[model samples]
Target: MISDEELMALMRYVDGECTDEEATAIRAQLAHDPAYRRAYNEVRQADEALAALPLLEPSTGFNFRVLNQLKAEPHKAVSPISLRKRLLHISGIAIFLLVLPSVLLLLSSGQNPVLILDGSWLPAVGDRQAQVALGPYLQPLLFVNGLLTLLLFDRGVLQPWFRQRHQPPA
Candidate 1:
């Protein structure tokens, strides 16, 4: 299919509305591109046909027939959301809002949340050398842990809950 831009250019070329440079470019395209040429011909034919068509007047009963058809269809009542579902949605939003602020406040307070790790299974970082060596990797380790937690949370809880909530009743 020819793109809208190409179609517009062809239409303008057909209508003698394009500049000389644009018309030349379009003419080159029409000569070299079979698809573009076909599209241009189709547009030109449609425009000519529309111009040749006489102005049409609707029949005297057209409005009456349309109104009668509209009246024949039964009206549908929109069902309000159930109270339980509404409450569930509201609670989810409320929890998110509350926890977001608490998390932001804690992070902004500049107090480092301490982690107590059991490193007894691993080789001891004797003296201060190994600890210093591992210090650079601590941030990356924390970042990976946070990313994994979020992925697991999304897969296990968020996705299931969302699917259940949005799925239509069978």
Candidate 2:
């Protein structure tokens, strides 16, 4: 069987890319070796067949049609701020607002003796004084606020930061 280097040399010679010395060596081999001669003839025949085929030309309106098609298609615009990110920011702000009132009520509860003395500040519930005080609900509210704060930090801050770090550069 003919080697890859011999075949490549034959191709280069057929394409008129070989030096005089290389072409001389290949010509000598082709004359002496039947396999080399056959391979060389096959390569020459294929090149000649390809060269004989007519070259194709595009229509006169090809460029205009392509440009018109490109213009007809709508290009999607990428927004700088995504809807999900906006919603996350707005929700984080709202959660912060909710947490503020609970925090203030909890903190001011100890200092404000007048509010504690008068349960009348809380509206009555159907002929009975509303036994429900801010004291009991404050701890649970703070707990929920802590959870929301953690959620906000994770979704709004850590997730986006991590995604940005791991993304493949454009």
Candidate 3:
């Protein structure tokens, strides 16, 4: 049995890929070794068979047809506007579901609300003497809400407007 290296050398020789020195060594081996000669003959016959097959040519308009088919397919990319609108809706729902109820609860508590910080300047609600003590949370909650509102506005409204303004006429 011929080794894999010997078979590869025979294939390389058949393909004219072997160096002159390597080809000479393979030729000597083929003359002396019957197994080497048989492998070389098989490799050469397969190579000639492949070379004898006719080359295939595409029909006319093949490229155009492929391009047209590609264009006909709907694009799979998600639109930025739709994504922004979705985010805006989700944020709005979150604020309504989470923040609004807390604010309402705080307001409806009616008992003289404890003020953690000085709220003397705050006006009384109805006949109450003091303001609702929103504790240390009110300022931060309002600030976060303001920031979220700005972010939603930028993403939902300003970004799309700016993109439209900057886009080349197309």
TM-score for each model: 0.33, 0.38, 0.42
Regarding TM-score, does 2 or 3 come out ahead? 3
- Point out the worst 10-residue segment of candidate 2 by lDDT: 111-120
lDDT (0 to 1) per candidate: 0.69, 0.77, 0.75
User: If the candidates were sorted by their lDDT against the true structure, best first, what order would they fall in?
Assistant: 2, 3, 1
Candidate of highest lDDT: 2
Residue 106 miss distance in model 1 (angstroms): 73
Off by over 4 Å in 3: 1-32, 52-54, 72-97, 115-132, 135-147, 153-170
* Clashes per candidate, residues 3 or more apart or on different chains: 0, 0, 0
lDDT of 1: 0.69
Model 3 quality (TM-score): 0.42
- Superposition TM-score, candidate 1 onto the true structure: 0.33
Candidate whose TM-score is highest: 3
Q: Model 2 over residues 14-116: C-alpha lDDT tens digits? A: 9999999999999899889998899999999999999999998778699778876764544546466665775777687687787778677766768422223
lDDT of 3 at 93: 52
